[model samples]
Every structure is written in structure tokens, then in C-alpha cells.
Target: MNLGDLAYPDVPTDAVHLLPLGATEPHGPHGPLSTDTIISVGICERAAERLEGEIPVLVLPAVAYGVTRYGSAFAGAVSISEETLRSLVGEIAEAVGALVLVNSHFEPEQVETLRSTGLPLLDLTRRRNAERLTEEFRAGSCHAGRYETSLVLAERPELVHADRMTALEERRVDMPAAIRAGRTDFVAMGMEQAYCGAPGEASAEEGSETFETLATMLVELIREVAA
Candidate 1:
């Protein structure tokens, strides 16, 4: 059930609450600005469906802004301070004591901020979780590449700029490595078009499969807490 769709009296106290955490940032020229948000919501919704008979689930409204400092060079990139994000998340977590964070944005600051909340989080940046995802994602170059593009394609195909996606070439910049080396933004990390990985090779079939993995991971996390 969606928390936003429920009245005060209808809210379930025993259900595991999912808070979709995402960012509003540029996803190259082919992907939508809300790519991260879309993916987070997709994972939460899918997980909620899977947990229906096993455990009650309530998906909260998405928090669509995060510490997106890497995309700062882009026009559409919007970010909040880590302190601010931590405070906001802390408040939300306090209110919904059984909440779990389902995040799609992988920026370092964002990851750190979410971790500071001490809430159960499905952080895809971790090796164990990242390894379960597609190869492109594990390589850490999938900012708006095949992995993310495939997710967007699976969740919201109409939002993808097909013309631009088809015309683009693969950019294999190791974003995580570059960030570790002190690269501040997409431009510094050699992401000229604000994207990396093989976006041209993205397919909805791969996306659907990836979503299943993500949802499964979320469900497992919820079960660990709900138990």
C-alpha cells in the first residue's frame, strides 16, 4: 500500500515502511533528470508487490533530492547539503521507526549521508549489493549508462530520449575510481556528455531482470528487520 494514498486511520502500523530515496540530477542527454528517482520508486513498488502475502508493506512518497554534488556542473543538477539531508532523513526515520531507505543515487556524499542515519538501507553502492546487479553497474561507470538506462527503460520508457540514446557512443569512464581520486564533477571525471557505460546496449528485458534482483534485495532487507 502507498502511504500517500492512505487516510490517517487506514495507515498500517505493522507494515514495513519503504522510503524511496533518489536525486534530481542530469542523467546524460538520453536519460531523464529523474532517472534515479524513477529507479528507486520502481524498486520499492516491485518489492511491495513481492512482499504482499509474506508481509504487509507500505511505500512512502519518494524523497527526490539528495547529495548530488558530482552533477553540479550540469544545468539541471540540484543538490542538498549532507547535513541537511541527514537531518531530514533523521526526522523521517524518527516518525516511521520501521522505515527502510531504498536509494538509487550513488554519489559518495549521498551514500555517506544515508549511512549516517543508521536506518536499514538498501545501498546498491556496497560490493555485496553491487555484485548482484548487472556488469555495467558493478564496473561503477554506470552513471547514466546501460545499467541505469535499462532501469529507466524498464520503469519509464517514455522518459528516455531514444533519438539521443541511439546516437551516442559508449563511455567507459570509471566514475567511482575517478571520484576516489578527487574528481569533483562529471566533467572532471571525463564524462563529457554526463554519462558513462554502454547505454546503447540497454534493453528493457535486462532492466526487468535487474529490477527483480533489486526488489528481492529490498524484500530480504525488510524481512531481516520485520522479523
Candidate 2:
């Protein structure tokens, strides 16, 4: 169940509360700025639906801004300070005792900030989890590539500009490698158009499959924490 749809009296205090975390950042010319948030909320919604029959589940309204330093050069790349993000999430977690964070924004600062919250998280950035994702994702070139673009296509096709996506050529940059080398921003990392990877290869079918995998992973994390 979605927490936003319920009244205070109908709220289940004992339910497993999922808080989807993401960022308002530029995805590309083809994708919407809310891509990260949409992907995160989609995973939380799917996980909640799958777990509701087995246990009480509440998908909280997503936190749609994060520590998005990399995309700051791009338009609409709104970000909050790490301290602000940590405090905001920490406050919410305190109010909702049984909380699990479902985050899709993979900026290193964002990931580290969430990790500081000490709550259970569906962190796909971890090697074990990253290995389970699509090839483009694991290659670290999936900023607005097939992996993320496909996800947006599946969750909100109307938001994806098909013409722009099809017209863009593949731009492959090893993001993880660049990060290791101390590249701080998207442009510095060679993402001139504020995107990387292969947008032309995205497909909604692949997105649906990827969502299932992401939801399953979230479900597993919730089960471990809720146990």
C-alpha cells in the first residue's frame, strides 16, 4: 500500500516501511529529470505489491532529491547537501521505526550519505548486487544509457523523447573508473551531453525485466531486515 494514499487511522505502524530515495537530476536530452526518482519509486511500488500478501507493506512517498554533485553542471540537476540529506532521511527513519531505504541514485556521495543513515538499503552499487544487474549497469557507463533509459521507457514511456534517444550516438565512459581517478563532475568525466552509455539501445521490454530483478532484490533486503 502507498503511505500517501492512506489516512493516519488506516496506517499500519507495524508494516515494513519502504522509503524510495533518488535525485532530481538531468538524465539526458531524451529522458526526464525525474528518472532516478521514478525508477526508485517503481521498485518500491513493485516490492510493496509483492510483499503485501505476505506481510503489511507501505511504500512511502519518494524522497526525490539527493546528493547529486556530479550532475550539478547540467540543467535541473538540483541537489541537497550531504548533511541535509542525511538529516532528512534520518528524521524520517526515526519516525518510522521499521524502515528500509530503496535508493536508485548511484552518485558516490549519495550512496555514502545513505549508508551513513545506518538503515537497511537496496544498494545495487555493492559488487554482489551490481553483478546481478544488466551488462551496461555493471560496466559503469549507464548514466543515461540503455540500463536507465530502458527503465524510464518502461515506467514512463511518455516522458522519454524517442526522437532524441534514437538520434543520440552511443557515448561510453567508465564512470566507476573515472570516479576512482578523481573526476568530480559529469563534464569532467567526459559526459558532454550530461549523459553516457548507449541510449539508442534502450527498450521497454528490457526495462520491465530489470525492474523485476530490482524489485526482487529489494524484497530480499526487506525480508532480511524485517525478520
Name the top lDDT candidate.
Answer: 2
The stretch of ten residues in a row with the least summed lDDT in candidate 1 is 171-180
How well is each residue in 91-120 modelled by candidate 2, as lDDT tens digits? 998888899998889999999999988889
After superposition, the stretches of candidate 2 with alpha carbons farther than 4 Å from their true spots are none
Residue 171, candidate 1: C-alpha displacement in angstroms? 0.4
Summed over model 1, clashes come to 0
lDDT of 1 by residue, 4-65 (tens): 99999998788899999999999999999999999999999999999889999999999999
Evaluate model 1: give its lDDT: 0.91
Model 1, which residues run further than 4 Å from truth? none
